[model samples]
Target: MPQIAIGMPVFNNQETLARSIDSVLQQTYGDFVLIISDDGSTDGTWAICEYYARVDSRVLIFRQEANLRYMNFKFVLDQSQTEFFCWLAGDDYYSCFFLEKCISVLNHDASVVCSVPKCQFTAPAGNLSLAEGTFPIVQDEIDMRVTQYLYCPSDNTRMYGLFRSEVLRDSFPPRGFHAYDWALSAQTLCFGKHQEIDEVLIYREKTKRALYTGAVLRDERGLLKQLFPVFRMSVWLLRQKKFPRRRGVVRALIWLNLVKHMEYVSNVHPDFYERSRFFYTYLKKRL
Candidate 1:
């Protein structure tokens, strides 16, 4: 088996799929398998993946007859047999040393679930710009802060991070969550801590078709749909007997979600004020 497996789930990303695949093919660390799952793309995504598969033995491709979203993404990762696992989106590409540096962290520390290297953000029409790096959290403080900051009423983390294969297997993402990254990060923290590297190894593309493109706060119904799965995850963590710190983080996330719902009421969903008020009051008492 390859030392590392890079999994990507593609859906209608034909325009940028080739570039994303090339980015993985160009990785400095050559002993890795690029696993691409074409989730029933009607566009040229499958053809592009096929072309790359024929040319490179390292590239593995699969196709589905129907579209599957975040839940199917977990399936792709589950299929990986590599010692280390990372994911690249169909619309995003990574720097040459991304896998090399991330794998180095796992090599150095067997306990570390993942290492997040410095990230660069790029707009479709503009050049790449440096983005912030997360600080290492031996305890759960930094993890809590990251959760709060990313899911804040007005802020969201622009960059994405990688994860270890075992970590992914241990803490699968909650089904049907629109903000799957939030749950993934929470699970990573629960399994093992993360370290941050200063090397800029991932380039996040700010494309219009990307998931978080439109106004999040303005979409009240959509926001509520996203929050339910997160709320369920928090409840699941609270029932666990493992880490007390995780329970605390779950409480914090509950309040954050309540506050976010309240913020939505304050701005766009005034008619739902009573419902939001009830949720806040109930959660406030529980916390």
Candidate 2:
């Protein structure tokens, strides 16, 4: 079997699908499988995946009946049979040395569960800027990593890093609601610390932030659940028994982060935070 497994989940991403596939196929470390799952894409995405599978022996492809959203991510990762694993969004592309560098980190340190590189955000209009790195997650202390990760605003690019396949499988919990990615991330911290590479090598396309659109929630059912999302997400994360000893500490941290999250969101996304911007307004007046 190959040393690494890469899952690429695509849904109506025909425009950027080939670019992502090409980036993977161009990796300097080529001993890996690129698993592509078409999540009921109506566009030419399936055709693109099929085309790559035919041309590259390393590429494997599958198609889903419906838009499974985050489940599509799980589906691709489930089919993996490799020591190292990572997920590459259909809209994103990585540097040729990405896999090589990440694998080196994991090989050199058994304690590191994942190796994440700094990501460079790109827009359709060609604007580009490097995302900040140095997440407090590198610490071996589980509570420190989990609390810092939960409290701070991340670029949401760490999940795209190379993970030890066993830890990757264990980190993922059963899907429960919107922002399930955030929950999985917190859970990953429970297992081990993640190493972040300082180089800006990952090129992630900016996904839309429109709340009601398919951008935030996949199925319409998630709309109601998004109300009070911070607590809902925390409740889901706290249910896991991964860190039973740290539950009390984690609980306090969650509450603190929840308030901070509300304030952060209201300031960063005031329009989506509602016209009242209650969190921003109320906190400002009180402070």
**lDDT values for all models:** 0.67, 0.77
TM-score of 2: 0.85
lDDT of 1: 0.67
lDDT tens digits, residues 1-287, model 2?
99999999899999999899999999999999999999899889988988888999999999998777788888988999899999999999999999999999999988888898888989879988776533537776877778677655455678888999988788676774656677777788788878888887689987644433343334325434333455565676667778534664565455544554564456556688786576556754443
At residue 84, candidate 2 shows an lDDT of 92
Q: What are the runs in model 1 whose C-alpha is more than 4 Å off? A: 125-133, 140-160, 207-229, 239-247, 270-287
TM accuracy, model 1: 0.78
Kindly list the per-residue Cα lDDT of model 1 for residues 98-166, writing each as its tens digit: 888877887888667777777777886787666543555445554564354434422122224556777
